[model samples]
Target: MTIRLASIEDHAALAGIFLSVRRSTFVWEDPASFQLDDFASATEGELIHVAETAENGIVGFISLWEPEQFVHHLFIANGHRGKGIGRALLDDLARRQPGPFRLKCVAGNSVALSFYKRSGWAQIGEGETDGRPYLLMELSKTDESTLSSPST
Candidate 1:
């Protein structure tokens, strides 16, 4: 499997992967709100990326806004779940040595909630969109700097 940064030229393929995942995972959350045109908004130098397989390709993807490091989205093709792909993506991102990381999960999405929890993210807050509540989870890289209490 290969995971790499996505370029603007990858718009079509990336959009298709996202649309497919949306149908299954985001049926209620986003519906058709996320579109192909949105790929152009990715802009290079960001953390957006796609994951491909050795043979059956474009299996999954993930992205987050820079600095804020708020996870925008992550999805694996329907048939590709249960493998370590999702975990690999998370592990790879965590290994990148960022200051802090965050992602929001729909309150009803038990699968996603559990996945994030097992990966060491703790609930910090929540958000609501269109009357649906989303639980925000965060992972702060454990380092000497973070272990120390903030000074007043």
Candidate 2:
């Protein structure tokens, strides 16, 4: 397996994997929250990284925010969970994003919470917004080990 930069051609394949895993991984979220529709050519301060097999088939991805390097979204194929693909993606992003990175996890997403915790991301604070619970978490730019595994 390999992790590398993503391109427009990778969007469709990545989106397909996302859809297959969304129902279970993101059950706390709306099924359509961030479907990969307009991102086929997504650009400008956006970085989408993909984890693929040796033959170049997409399995998972993580989006790193430009300037801040905060991880925006990460997902792995439902069938590929527990295989460390998520960690590979996170490690790649951490190596590239050079700042105190941050991400939000819903209050009820125990799986995600555990993932973040095990990966070395610590909870800083939390509250609800738009009826959804949110916890503010950050990963120091130098601590690339924190995302070893997204708990769930």
Candidate 3:
């Protein structure tokens, strides 16, 4: 799979990927509530990177709002999970912003929670969004050295 910055031409594909992944993963949310136009508007003016395969087109994407130091969105297309695409996208983000990174995972989404935990993110707190509970996670730059140090 190739990971690269998204271009204007990629908007429609990216929006579709986001819709599919979000619908499948966040089943608790009303799927009908997620509109393609909303996804496009939400992703506008952000730093987005897409993962594409020659055979499958755009399979995943990660978006970051640099000004806010937040990961606005990260989604992998249906049937495209567990293949390291998420990690590759995140690795790209870390390379670009080697500072504190933060994101929220819906509390009941165990798959996402586990992935984030395994990816070196620590849960700092909890909150609710649209009435759904979420865990606030962060990967601090300082934590990197701590994570690499030999445990004594």
- Candidate 3 structure lDDT: 0.82
Each candidate structure's TM-score, on Cα atoms with residue i matched to residue i, is 0.79, 0.80, 0.88
Q: Among all windows of ten consecutive residues in candidate 2, which has the lowest summed lDDT?
A: 143-152
Clashing pairs in 3: none
Residues 1-152 of candidate 2: C-alpha lDDT, one tens digit per residue: 77778887787787677666765566766776656653443333668888888654787888877766667778887777787887677776766666677888887888778888777688888988888988988777456444454322
TM value for model 3:
0.88
Q: Which candidate, 1 or 3, would have the higher TM-score against the true structure?
A: 3
Candidate 2 pairs with clashing backbones:
115-150, 115-151, 119-146
Q: Report RMSD (Å) for each prediction in the order shown.
A: 6.7, 4.2, 4.8
Q: Tens-digit lDDT track for model 3 on 40-72?
A: 788777899898888999898999988877888
lDDT of 1 by residue, 73-130 (tens): 7778778887777766766666554748888899999999998887678999999977
TM-score of 2: 0.80
